[model samples]
Target: NNMAEAIASAIISYKKEYFGSQADVNYDKTLSSKAAESTKSKRIADNKVLKARNSNVVFKVQFAAGNKKIKLNPSNFKGLKNVSVRTRNGSFYKYAYGDTSDYAVAKKDLKEVKSKGYTAAYIIAFRDGKSISVEEAIKL
Candidate 1:
């Protein structure tokens, strides 16, 4: 319901005299103000969206690390379908549905992947892929 309507309903529902000689109208005003303040405080808190300190951190763990595949934390790579891995030298590699398409092609095209200078790689979702530079990836 609307905030104004809710506040009005609360004022009406409060168990205090309204029309009698013992009616406490002043108390009703204080109660309404307190409720309004509480609701406003809650809304302000909920509106805040916290951002991650390290945005380059690729939560994915499973990737072909040379001949031997290396998997980090299983929970980190969960529900990841399409992903794009970026190398240190501004090269991009894409994979979908657990398919690592043409590792040789990626390795050849992305000179950074082959170079030891590559600081880090990012495995982000294709839908909401995180776009971060090599410097940021290294921080992750």
Candidate 2:
């Protein structure tokens, strides 16, 4: 009988030390380190979403392209530091220019590309590494 009493006393003290004596009296006993960790994880996920929402919108001016290697060269297209030759849908070579997150800023860049002989240059946005409509990118 004495051994049983000592064990019970030890368990109660352990609970009080970890969960607090108030937790013992509560109807719900879900308070634990694991629950605290779950709350922290949810907060971390919410922070990521907020960061994505605040990210700058990006665009590029597609100047030229070809199903195969272009007759011309991308190196001679423009001197923009952000100019790049990217593969579209893994099929064609596309020469694009400019890097801006603002829509109005991209329009100004488009004008510059047009002046450089890329009259058909246009603005396009990307999301998660895939191209999307500028309208859609703005909405996001």
Candidate 3:
């Protein structure tokens, strides 16, 4: 189809017009507009994750809640990974799965989590990694 050649030509033209000589030197790295955009998006997402570690409010599926600490691993979590734990006053540990700011994504995760044998799993919200009501998280 020569699609790659066409895309390369387009990218070179775009760089020559918009970014000039310096961009031409880096043109091979970007390949196409979509690739350039994807790189930019990845950087943005990485920054968000860094920020989320400290201040972002996110929704997660709480699959296990108990006073005792259970080691987090695929074996412990029914072959599922990406698990995290939150505790209150060093008293109770809430084991949660998935981490996203999108409520819809959290809902979807909840459904999958239940299907994984965690029938009682539900969506929970956290602000700075502390438990908060779903309604409050949405408002924030």
By TM-score, how accurate is candidate 1? 0.16
User: Hey, what RMSD does candidate 3 come out at?
Assistant: 20.0
List the candidate numbers ranked by lDDT, top first: 3, 2, 1
lDDT of each: 0.31, 0.53, 0.62
Clashing pairs for model 3 are none
Q: How many backbone clashes does candidate 2 have?
A: 0
lDDT of 1 by residue, 22-132 (tens): 222222223344345434433542443212234333333113222212233433333333333333222222221222222222223223331322223212212135433
For candidate 1, give the lDDT of residue 53.
Answer: 33
Best-fitting candidate, scored by lDDT: 3
- Pairs that collide in candidate 1 are none
The parts of candidate 3 lying over 4 Å away from their true place are 1-55
Q: In lDDT terms, how accurate is model 1? A: 0.31
Candidate 3: tens digits of C-alpha lDDT, residues 33-127: 43443333334444443223333789888676555678998899888788997665565566789999876577678778878887656566778
How well does candidate 2 score on lDDT at residue 91? Answer: 52
Provide TM-scores for the models.
0.16, 0.52, 0.56
Instruction: Give per-residue CA lDDT, model 2, range 16-114, as digits (tens).
Output: 434433211311232343234323333443443322242555666665555554434445665555677665455556666776665556667877886
Model 1 lDDT-worst window of ten: 61-70
